[model samples]
Target: MTANASVFVEKLRSVVGDKGLVTDARARHPYLTDWRENYLGTALAVVRPATTEEVAAVVKVCAAEKVAIVPQGGNTGFMGGATPDESGREIVLSLARMSRILEVDTIGYSMTVEAGVVLKTIQEEAAAHDRLFPLSLAAEGSCTIGGNLSTNAGGVQVLHYGNARQLVLGLEVVTPAGDIWNGLRALKKDNTGYDLRDLYLGAEGTLGIITKAVLKLWPKAKDVATSWIAVPTPDAAVELLSGAHAASEDNVTSCELMSRQGIDLVLKHLPGAADPLTDRHDWYVLLEWSSTRARREAGNEGGLTEKMEGYLGEAMEKGLVLDAAIAQNEAQARAFWALRENHSEAQKREGPSLKHDISVAVSRIPSFMREGLAAMKKVLPEGRPVPFGHVGDGNLHFNCQAPAGWDKARFMKHGDAISRAVYDLVVSYGGSISAEHGIGRLKVDELAHYRSKIELDVMRTLKRALDPQNIMNPGKIVRV
Candidate 1:
């Protein structure tokens, strides 16, 4: 290490202590790479701050030294947002040591938590208080709430509870210059000046570090129903969902669309995974509906299950659904969900893949999927498409699995062309190229190219205004 880097490490160790500063190459391995293994970067050291005060102090030191800091929480991001650059000058600021649940306001329907608190822990804490924290995803077990808010994560529940932005009421942030902005107000109707909470929620830590958050919570579900159905086409899936909103009495919690190819991958690679339906179909829908009303024991209508059973029966009669499998118990419901949640892992095991997180108007999903598949084939004829996601919200993980036995190096050669075609199609449909994943280092060039000049200018202007030193997660989101 250089003399300046050695001095910087000592300064950081002074604030967080020797235990907090991980200088060993083996110890810093996990912090340097992303979850997907797409970005393996190098850092001067891995700094673990136990509290917001420590975070602010570390930021102050980095600011004074002009050394770049990569603020990471859980480091489960797909776009390489939390991963540091290859330059060994940057430091990886891990929030793992700061995990804590500060407060649970049952009456106020809000909970305050540290940024490093695992999302699952927060959910369990809220549930113990008879409240639901609806921000959920496949990575909930490992991903932290800070990373979720930083990326403004949207999961299966987005169709009901909205994204992480809507799930939080306030945040406590550490500014680029070490100033603490504690706006952790539990107010639902704050008409304050510029909404800084919204700015940092999806800024991907380019603007500031989210140390703590006041998250909105909802009543726990008393009755729930989950179903895996085989639909004729994407159009039919959309129609099925359009009717489900009312059939379930607006209790539709999630409506995920999966292609046959994706399902086949899960069944083949995932050991415990099984086909919910008998016959193979081109399209499938994993629909869930939950209501706060508890189901009474003695009644012909058991609960959401019976209601959904009737709804699916009608849908089948109308040719909207070809076949279906409704969960009989909670375990069965979880099994149904497991198939959806295990998609990422299954894809990883299958082979090299290109993930496109795009979204459009709900009504336009059918047409968009049709055109998107065609566009993918046009760009890379051999690319096996495995498109699936929250169809109810118009966000699809339009992924392209590599052909048969193609290696990563061989398959990634056509990634750029395929992505360009898919993005152009999404743009033509008035959809977003990035629906949930922020424009981290991976998509920085794409953001510059696809986004309007005015939008880019506004973003760049904000980055410079807040992080004048350009040390906070430098070379991420937008370069100042």
Candidate 2:
């Protein structure tokens, strides 16, 4: 290490103590690479701060020496948003040690937690109080609230509860200049000017580091109905979603679409995974409806389950749904959901693939999927397209697998071209290139190519104003 880096490391060690600082290459490997293993980076040192005050102190030392800080949480992001570069000049500021669920206000319907707390922990804490923290994701077991807020994570429940940003009431952030901005207010209304909480929520840690947050919660649902339905095409799935919303009075908690191939992979790769429907169809939808009213109070008054069944029966009669199977109990519901949750893992077993996380208007999803698939096929005819995800919200994981019998390396050679074609179609449909995942280094160039000049200019202005030295997670979101 250079003299300056050595001095910075010494100061960081002093702030976090020897136990919190990791300099060994092997020890830092896990934090430096992303969950997908697509991004590999090297850092000067991995520093774990046990408290917000320690975090600020570490940042202060790093800022004084003009060193880059890559703020990391559970490190489960598909994008390399939390990963450092290979320059060895950056320090990984991990929040794993600062995890603490500080407050749970049952009456207020809110919870306060430190940044490092796992998403599942928050959910369980809320549940113990008969409240629900509805930000559910596949990585909930390992992903941190700080990372969720940084990326504004959207999961299956977003159809009803909205994304992570919408669930948050306030945040406590450590600015790039090593100053603390305490805005952790749990009030429902404070139409303050500029809304600084939002400015940092989806900034992907480029502007500042989120140290803690006040998150919104809801009453636990007493009635939940999950079902796997078969649809003839994407158009039918869209119609079914609309019809279900009308029937349930907007109580539809989740609506996920799966291609035939997506399900086949799950059954093939995931042991004991079964097909929910008797007959196979070109497309499928795993939808759920939930109600908070007690079953006794909802007796014979058309609860969520009755509403869901009535809607599905009507849909089947109208030919919108080809077949349907509703879960009889909690175990059955979980089993049905396992099929959807295993999509990414099952696809991994197939081979190397190019994945696109894009979104369009709900009404335009059918067209987007049709056009996107055709565009990708035209570029690489032998490629297999697996388009599936939260179709209720218009976000589809448009992933393409290598043609069978071809080596992984040869298939990856066409990844760039396939992605360009798919993204171009997404743009044509007025869709975002990145739906849930933030634009880390993975899609930095695509963001530049697609975003308008004024948008890019505004982003750069904010970056320069907030992190003038470009030391806070640089080379992400916007290039400064």
Candidate 3:
């Protein structure tokens, strides 16, 4: 430990008090490691500040001591964004104790929530008031609202409602220098310059810490329809998505593509998961459409299930879909969603894998899958490339599960080489490398390689301008 280490700890404890300060190594284990267990880091201590002002004070002390503050929420980020470094030079500022639902204005169609509020809790609170909070993710049960906003997380609902950044109206951030930037408002239309809210949305805490946010909400989707369709290939899945979109126009909410391999993995690895169709197909899509109860009462055309049935029939005739099963009630609807949401967990049980969250143009999704999967197999002969995700939004998980009975370490050795090959192809098709997960420590190099020089320069400039000291979440996002 440094000569001044004890003094630093004493100051931090003074800021957050003894109850909020955690210094034991065992107690800090959960905060030091990421959700995927890919990155195991060490921290001087894990400090929990219960309010935004307390967070600011803690950050201010750390900045003065020239110590790094790793802003963590839920520790549920997959890319190691919330995890600290192995050097043990940083302090983990956990927002877990800042769990407060500040306000829920149904009339304004928005809610102001503290950063540590569990995502599922916010959803339930919204539901209680007859409103919907649509920033849903697989980790909704454990991930905090702050972490979701930091990563700008995308889930199955992203095809219908946008990602976390789009759902947020404003943010309250603690700058690196310890000043709190308060921009919390429920304004739908703000013609402000630069849209500063976006800067913090996906910054991964490089510029500042997100303490609270004003998130947009929607009227509860009462009349809803869900379907699981079997398709011949990714090409066929694309056709089905287009057909459904054409049928529902604006009402089409969720469109997710699932590979047969992905579904099989889910059923085999995850309990209570089942195939909705009797016969297996190469690919499948779970789609949903929704409308408010008031809208449903106005006309028969508003019935999403009937409209989807007609669309499916047309798609079958056109050879776009082989067969499909539309959920008849809420119970079946939940079951269908379970199959899609259980993908990551199921894949984990299969083996350690190289996961990519990349996106291309919607029209190019099929081609990207065809070419990308082929390229990956060529590099590693025994690789099982499972490409599936939000086909409607053109984002594919494009993960490669290790071949059966292969050495886990040896297979993982080629992770970078394989990532390079896949990312190169994505760029050729004008796609993004880090689609939903931010460019945390994991993808920093990938971002440098795939991002244009001009874009990198702009990002660096922004980071430098906002965080001149570079004390906020060091070694994340931009290299600065």
Candidate 4:
């Protein structure tokens, strides 16, 4: 270990006590690696703080020692945001022990939760109070609120609820200099200057470490209608989405588009999972609508179901929808959701792949897909272009899997070439390279390359203004 690391470890252990400090290699293994196992790291020591105050104190010690510290929360990120570098010089400051739901103000329609609180737990707690925390993700069970905020996670609900940035009302963050900023207010209106909360929301622990957050909540939906539909192409899926939007604007909570190859991958990997439709189609859409009013108040009195049926009827007549299956009950709804949610997992099982989280205008999604697929196919070997995700929000996971019997190493060897082709097309189409996940270490170079000179300079200015020493999550989001 470096002399600086030894000094930092000593100081960290003193602040958090021996019980909270992990020095053993095995104990620190989990924190040293990321969720996807693509980026493994080595830390001087993993320090677990049980409270926000303890986190501040730990940061203070690391700051005093001039040691770089990476704030980690559940380490469930996809882009290596929480993983450290190979130097083994930085300390992993973990907030897992600070797990607490500070308050749930049902009347105020908000919940104050510590960064360590698991996303799924907060959802359940909100449900217990008959409210809904709409920031949902597949990793909700293991991912922490801090990671979600850092990444500005947009799961299947971005259509109705917006991303994590929109859901957050306030945040309490510990700056890189070890000072705490308590901005955890549930107020909807706080135009007190520049939006500091936003800078940290998707900063990926570069500017500060999020300690607590106040998140917006919605009235629990009492009635939901979910349908899995097969479409001829991405264009048809986009048309179907337009139909749903015309039918129910804000009530159409989710509209996900999946390709045929994506469905086949899921079926090949996951057990007991079947194709939703009888005939194979190039694309599919999972659309859903929810109502705050109960079924008796909605279907019987408000004509909610009739409106949905009418919309589907018109869509079918237009030939936008090839085949559709509306979920008969909650069980069937979950089954349909399972097929959509398991896309990432199934893709992982396929083998080494080049993943791209991209977004375009909702109307131009089909064009982006056609152009992006052609571009990727040109550079890549006989690979599979599995583009699927929240078409309602225009965010697509345009990932590439190798062809059958293809060598994983050979496919991954051209990962950079594949990424360049896709990202270049995305930029040409007025799209964002990252739709949900932030520019963590995985996309640091991409940020530097794609970001304009002025924008990159401003980001650097902010990083230097907030963290001059370059201690907090170095080589992430923006580097010093």
Best by TM-score: 1
The residue-by-residue lDDT of candidate 3 on 1-480, one tens digit each, is 675888788888888898899877678799988877889998877899988999999988988877898999888777889889998889999999999999999999999999999999999999999999998778899999998999899887887899988999989999998999999977888997878899888888888999999999999987788999988888888777776777886787888998888888888987777788899788898889887754457667548788888889988999888999999999999999888888888878888888899999988998888899889988997888888888878888999998887667888888888998999999999999988978788998888877789999999998889888777888888787
Worst 10 residues of 1 by lDDT: 293-302
Q: Cα lDDT of all candidates, in order? A: 0.92, 0.91, 0.87, 0.87
Question: Which candidate achieves the best lDDT against the true structure?
Answer: 1
Runs in model 1 with CA error above 4 Å? 297-300
User: 2 or 4: which has the higher lDDT?
Assistant: 2
Which residue segments of model 4 deviate by more than 4 Å?
2-4, 298-306
lDDT of 2 by residue, 1-480 (tens): 788778778988999999889877788899999877788998988999999999999889988888899999999888899999999889899999989999999999999999999999999999999999999988899999999999999999888989998999999999998899999999788987889999999899999999999999999998888999999889999999988887887789999998998888889999999888878888999999888876558353646777788889989998999999989899999989999988888877877778899999998988888888899999999998988999888889999978887777899888889999999888988899999988988999999999999999999999999899999999999899
**Residue clash pairs of candidate 3:** none
Q: Work out the TM-score per prediction.
A: 0.98, 0.97, 0.97, 0.97
The candidate 2 region of ten consecutive residues with least summed lDDT is: 294-303
Pick the winner on lDDT between candidates 1 and 4.
Answer: 1
